[model samples]
Target: MDMSMVWRQWLTRHDRVRDALPAVPLIVIAVAATAVGNSAWHEPHWDKVVWTALSCVPLVVRSRWPLQVALFTLAGDLTLMTVVSHTSPTPAACLVAVYTLALLGDRRTAWIVGFVAAVTIAGVYSATHADSVVGGAGLVRFDFALGATVLGRTVRSRRDNLAAAKARAERAERTREEEARRRVTEERVRIARDLHDIVAHHITLVNAQAGVAHHLMRDNPEQAYQALAHIKDNSRAALDELRATVGLLRQPDDTPGSRAPVPRLSDLDNLADGFRASGLDVRVTRTGTPSPVASSTELTAYRIVQEALTNTHKHGSATRAAVVVDYGAKGLRVTVTDDGRPGVPKGAGTGHGLIGMHERAAAVGGTVSAGPRAEGGFQVVAELPISPRSRLTPA
Candidate 1:
């Protein structure tokens, strides 16, 4: 359709033509030199014609089998120089062969070929020419071979260096892809944990309130009204918290009221009050003056307490539960325990409740332990680091 598009299509369709193009110039030079040499001598013998054709044809296939091509070209040129007159195109073809040998072969092979070329030139000149002048001509031919060998070696080195650089670039790209995948997996796990905590706690309370309203609808109108009100309140609160958590996943420009404040340690008292309304006798106590902490650490402390209390309500079979917070110089420690019957087994739900708590605490450079208390019920204890030094340190 367009000129640029047509040009690209042509290039793609003619890849084989591009690969064979470089040899065309070398072929032309060899043929022209042979023709000129024949004209100068005023003779066209069969042996000279055959030798010129052989020397030039090998250049066409040089790239496909550089080593074999060089060997054949060199052998042909040597035979022609010995039998035919020295004014042939053998000298130029021999130079091209030496360059190919050095480029395709290793350093050791190049050195060996250089030695053989030098010896052959000197021997041929001494046999054909009868003076010191031939020695100078042999030296000039040897120099050409040496220069071709050096040029080929330089090109080979550059090609190797480029290949190594490309390999390194590819490896770095793979590593970056792996790192991106790992970060995405971690973010997904965090969102799952947050969603679970938000929905499970509030929905559980809503269910309890709905059941209360259903049973008292006919006999106790006022109590039923209050129960219905509690259900509405719990559901609304759950929606608010869910919105806050999910907003974190939205683009900054797409977020809906992303400025909503996240729950922190200061909100634990209100949290306990909500649970108390749901028939969980929740008590909270604190010791030591609370010190400043990172926002993430504060959020982790709050979630740990929240998950523990939700578990107690569902599985502990406890009438009373207590939350204790101890703020020390190094860190903040929070513990939740319930006085449930030891014989009552834990709930049959997935054990992700405890796992979520552990992951939250670990994310904030903390440790959490959750299990049945030796004396009576279940307990959860978590210690979260708060010092500035701990905040800057890697997990």
Candidate 2:
């Protein structure tokens, strides 16, 4: 708090100082010039002091009305010159006025103001003092050229640098907007994949149980009751997982420094059990001691296997399926294959299962391929990066 107070005080002092700059210099110059002029003439010094004090009035408005102040101050100097008749101290006044115009105005305008002040002052002095007229013109010309060229160039360079800085700021803002749009798009895609993985597999269970209940309803009422029970349990499980997945979107505090549940490799057993309960034969195998897989890769691998099994239960009457997990030097490789139904007995199913599996693999910077293998069964395979701490590389 003390530091903040000190900073505010410094800013206040700085503004006050800036407001007192060129105007202060002009007032100081006027008083000195008037004093010197009166001494040279042997005149009433107090009258000279009053005229010089009046000259200071123009300086107060120098920043807002620079050109006007310059002219007003010059008029006061001329009134002094009239009394002394050719013994005017107008050289000092003209130099300062020309500088005010050059520092505040554009290059072209500054040149015009400088030339007019320079030539007119020199001409008036020459007319009054015939012996040194040419030398006076030489000095006036040099002063005008330096103010118009050198000082004008400095102002132009500053303006150019300011414009370039504004352009760079605009470009950086545009890049930031584009990056935000891309993240939003990717997040929506991830949510869609999760929804599909959660509900699609459970739908397969519902269809199979409904079929069993219908076929044995009259002949085997006890078996039909078990099928209906299975259907109810499957539907509830699907609801719970769906709620868990989608609740992430509405949770208010899931930003930096927030806690949230994100599913990982440990959830695979629950997923396998859900399919097995739905009456499909499923076996899980592992090879080469497992290493930590990235969270994104782990979740993607689980979803891919779930979708592939759902396809088997939907499109094939296959009684058995295999889920193979392998760890290699470069990545984690997963494959789910089933000799669909042992002799086709059901209808075609959710045609997008393969597409969903493929998309899941791709989301984690991986690859997926699904098709009938040369050995006569359908196979779904995916490969993912193994860097446990990294999922997506920086764009």
What is the C-alpha lDDT profile of model 2 across 284-378, one tens digit per residue?
88887798777677777878888888877777657788988999988999988887633343346556667777667666678898876555457
> What lDDT does each candidate get?
0.76, 0.68
- Where does candidate 2 have its weakest 10-residue lDDT segment? 386-395
Tens digit per residue, CA lDDT, model 1, 1-395: 89999977886677545434544565555455555653374334555666666676676666566677767777877777777755523355666767777887888988778667766765665566553424677667667777888888999899999999999999999999998898778888888888889888888787777777888999998988988888888887888888887777888688465535788888999888778777889999999888888888888888888888888887778989999999989999999999988777867879998999988877777899988877888989998889423322211
lDDT of 1 at 187: 80
Cα TM-score per model: 0.83, 0.60
Candidate 2 differs from the real structure by a C-alpha RMSD in angstroms, to one decimal, of: 9.0
Could you give me the TM-score of model 1 versus the true structure?
0.83
Residue pairs of candidate 1 with colliding backbone atoms: none
